[model samples]
Target: MSNFSSDGFDLDAISTQDNSDVIYEVGGGATVIQNEEPAMKEVEPSFNTSEHDQCEEFKKQGNEQFKIGNYLEAFDLYTEAIEACPSKFTGEEILRLKDEFDEKQRSEALQRSRLSEERRRKKEDEKKNGVSSSQPPESSKPQPFKTFELSQEDKNDKLAVYYCNRAATLQHMEKYNDALKDCDVSALLNPKYTKAFVRRSAAHERLEDTEAALKDAKAALELDPRNATIRKTVARLEKIEAERLEKLKEETMGKLKDLGNSLLGNFGLSLDNFQAVQDPKTGSYNIAFNQNK
Candidate 1:
């Protein structure tokens, strides 16, 4: 009675089909999803707490080795610990300790790198100049010069190396003042640093301070009497000094000659035959020459 099919209702007729897409109606309209979406696979995160424990365990082992004076063994263990957990073991307290470890490691690395670099540079320099760059004057800037903050623990040996090498760099720079300071440090850090003293001597020589250079060279010779290089340096410096003295004498004599000629008309004398005599005993000069004033 409510507007239904007045005569009859054809339910079978409304059961027709169309080849269009399937859409659902919700709030009076429908939207369609065309492509078939792929399904997602599940993945579990990798977090093995046991590995962290192992890392700690290895670090503890390294500490034990360090306590027992087994530095080499301690080094290996510490390396393993770092490899295991670089992130887990990061913190303020651990950072301080890690810095110590890092310093030690850096010290070792620097020694190796410096020596290898020196060899390479030396070979190249020798090839180019046909002489050993090592024989350069004390102020010669060192090849493979690099710097790093070093550990404070008995790092004298390590610092000695850097200071000595850097002194060479300073020498090459002609920064004699700074180079001498570095040499002092190197020598003080390691009294057995004979080369340091020898190098210091060379820098002094370059600065024309022969007295200090001779003293340093002597000290170096005392430490390592057999070093041919140091011996040669001493010989070269001695020769230089001798030549300097001789040249100085010649210069003084030339000045005296000029002075003697300049006295030609200074004193009015009847004849040009006047003579000046220097007494060998008194080092006093008695002059008799034509004077103008």
Candidate 2:
């Protein structure tokens, strides 16, 4: 005899309830939540870390690498620092500031126009009434214009330093043109930066632009007279320039001589047939025909 109790207990009903409960739990449970997917936790977006702080950190790393003569690494770090820099305000903020500036400028312009009109009217009235005086009318004290100072978003000093350092790295890598561009940017940012000028001079020297090199070296020397390197650089560039000019002069004279010889050959009278003799008194060369070749 099987031990089975009828007792109105349906096993099928219990199995069905079990399956339904499992499905409901997996499906997020409860009749109100039926057919609904599991709720996902709302995640708030994280704000970016301070750009100035990041830039400073990268700059520090770059300087360390530069000191170790790891130029490529230093350049990369410097680039990252530059990219991380928040040099300008957001577009919306800039627009708002510009609007305010424009409004203020418009108000000032209107005021100036009204004042000019009033002055013109007074002048005309005086002229009509024959109120001319020998002495010039008392000049009104000039009003002090309002000075508005806008806050800069980036650290200009740091940026200039980065550019100057990067230029140095590029120069060491023999990338003269790239180095020169960086040096230019550095100098524009900080006009008093002597190192930028010095680096720029080096770049020009490598590019064989002796004149530009000398100019920058002189500027650098003026800024830092005690710098022996700049003095030596200036001397070297001047010598190079002199030598280059002499070489160019020789080349030009050689070309002219070649042309003359070619033309003389066409006439069946080569340059060898002519002898130039310097007149002792006049210091001028006189051409003498040579009968014997």
- Residue 148 CA displacement from its true place in model 2, Å: 25
Q: After superposition, which runs of candidate 1 have C-alpha atoms over 4 Å from their true positions?
A: 1-158, 172-174, 190-192, 208-214, 260-265, 268-293
lDDT of 1 by residue, 1-293 (tens): 11111011010111114322212111112212132332863232233788657755665575455444454565466456545642322223333554566687778777877877787777787889887565533433434433333233322433343455445445544677777876765665556666577667867876888878877887887886776656666676677777888999999988876676577437533333556789999999887664542
Task: List clashing residue pairs in candidate 2.
Answer: none
Q: What lDDT is reached at residue 173 by model 2?
A: 72
TM-score of 2: 0.54
Worst 10 residues of 2 by lDDT: 22-31
lDDT of 2: 0.62
